[model samples]
Target: MTLSKKARSISALEIGLPIFAGKRFLDKDLNRCFGDLEASGTLIEEIRAQELAPLLKGTDILIDLHSTIKPSVPFVCVPKFDHPAAEIIPFFNTQHIITGDGLLTQDGKPIYADTFVNAHGGFGITVESGYENNSMLVELIRDSVISALKHLGVLQGKLECGLSRAVIEKTPYPLEECTIWDAYWNVIAGENFSWTKPWGNFDSMPAGTHFATSDSTKLVAEENSIILFPKDGANIIPGSEVCIIAKKQE
Candidate 1:
């Protein structure tokens, strides 16, 4: 997500208040998002070449952290199937879900890292820390970072229990190419999707069950598998439609 000056003000305030009050570590700005399109594009490429490339060369795991406007659920998104890191994280645990495909931006653009990694060669994943400026979400990110570092052998610690096994699928789902027209919602029924049941990619579904609808148009799941991350917030618009993510049977 693009961070504005106003947003960064809140971010700085949040980081400073905790540390000024006697937190153990001081939060440093890794990189700030510049609103300038040209500058930001240059920065992204330079960072990829000078920073990320060097660190990730020959590395097996990478974790990218991002904040979202969605509620509390954390999402671990993998663009490719069968990645070592993707094969380790759980599909559902503590409100976190491991997903492969979904609309990454409000503009209906596919995530860049997926394509970048395929071309450059590395395993990368995006970890969505839910709801902007939330302390609990921030803590969840910190914990996940610590756990990931330990898993990578960068940190030594006792492993916690109930570490769920990763649910891997044979075939990866394709990301949908779509455009957003306008925002719409069902008046009688709230939100057009469900996540109450834990479904894996390629998991089965009844043929006639309504998966989602826009305007008067309805969509259904062709086969059973876990549904990937659902569109959250006011991100989905009227003409926006996401390609269904399906996993092959285990």
Candidate 2:
């Protein structure tokens, strides 16, 4: 299969740059990075139609690169049963599915392959490489890109094996049933709002234990389940509740 004419000449797509406004990088400076990297001058939508959409139209596979604040773990992103590419997605180490709804954005709409396919008419997958400054994670990112290319037959090589595969499945945890709570931004003296124990995505919080609180208000778990992405740090936003509580899938 032939890559879009532009993709053949242009190598990779790079987003989240221009550390400072009103500045441009020289070709040599950009060359310091791998592949044909270019600045996405505007929001992705602005250029998607004029540039990327065409390149992705006839394309069978796409690999989106992204980084997370917590770069210690690598994860693969797949749409919610909306695209054909999901069939070929390789399971990553992490079992969590980074749905568009879970992501932080000004637009409340979720970002999934369905949206991309509707606009570009192709299959694509997004991969979160890890934290921005971690050099070690960069190597992992490179390996993931290579593996994806090989899977698509864009590159030639013996594919590295995965430890195991984690299929994407969803078990809904209602807000009321999961003992929903909000993470406070500030703490005051004599206030009771505090996390008694650290919590994270897919972790279990015991029933009746103080999970979090707001201004002397106590929040306790009503049931035990996998904490699908906790509101730790700025990773989760205000008003968002625990979307899922992990129970044995029947």
Candidate 3:
């Protein structure tokens, strides 16, 4: 989600003119542009070392908000399975929780904002809260942030985590899925790419089924796996991710 929506909402609530304007926080895409602090001599570190590293480090707890490419239900993504922040996953509006396996990016760098925060000794959780223009998303985000603050004692209020609702712990990728993504993932031009099925987020694909294709190269599932973040093939970049193969977690 963009900060401009929240900024506008806050300003509108305070004043009646709706005169508040929202601006992009960073000029560049901070996720792909920033380098992992653990690695040495990467382009991200070379360029953003002095600028971006300080903003991520030394935070007590971090909650990052992201928008999904496809329309999706809200979900929580924990950087690692063992972090202290895992306990708060059930507090959000979603039932799904995805945990990372500490896998490095294809460039041998960590690409996630929550990963950088957690790596630097802070408890961090990433929340993928549907689409950016979702009508109810702004309210959901504000309430979730308030809930987190209360849970951490930063705000003095009643907790609003969806305690009465059940939560599902998503499993990490199976070995076969990881191997396929590492080896067969193609950075194709997404001018005409689209999923064969109208697959929702985290929907399972059977073995030997086509996922998506562009021109002559088609991506098919090698085994039973679920898909994550299947992007709508619109005016997207060539290197943008289409989707990830995963296993359904109980």
TM-score of each: 0.41, 0.46, 0.63
Residues 28-56, candidate 3: write the lDDT tens digits: 23454434445563343234543656766
**Steric overlap count per candidate:** 12, 4, 0
- Of the candidates numbered 1 and 2, which has the greater TM-score value? 2
RMSD of each: 13.6, 11.6, 10.1
Report the poorest 10 consecutive residues by lDDT, candidate 3: 8-17
Write the candidate numbers in order of decreasing TM-score. Answer: 3, 2, 1
lDDT winner between 2 and 3, please give it: 3
Q: Sort all candidates by lDDT, best to worst.
A: 3, 2, 1
Q: Which candidate is the best by lDDT?
A: 3
- Please give the lDDT score at residue 33 for candidate 2: 21
Off by over 4 Å in 3: 1-28, 36-50, 102-104, 157-200, 214-217, 233-235
Of the candidates numbered 1 and 3, which has the greater lDDT value?
A: 3
Model 2 segments beyond 4 Å from truth? 1-11, 20-61, 91-108, 112-121, 130-134, 156-198, 206-224, 228-250
For candidate 2, what is the TM-score? 0.46
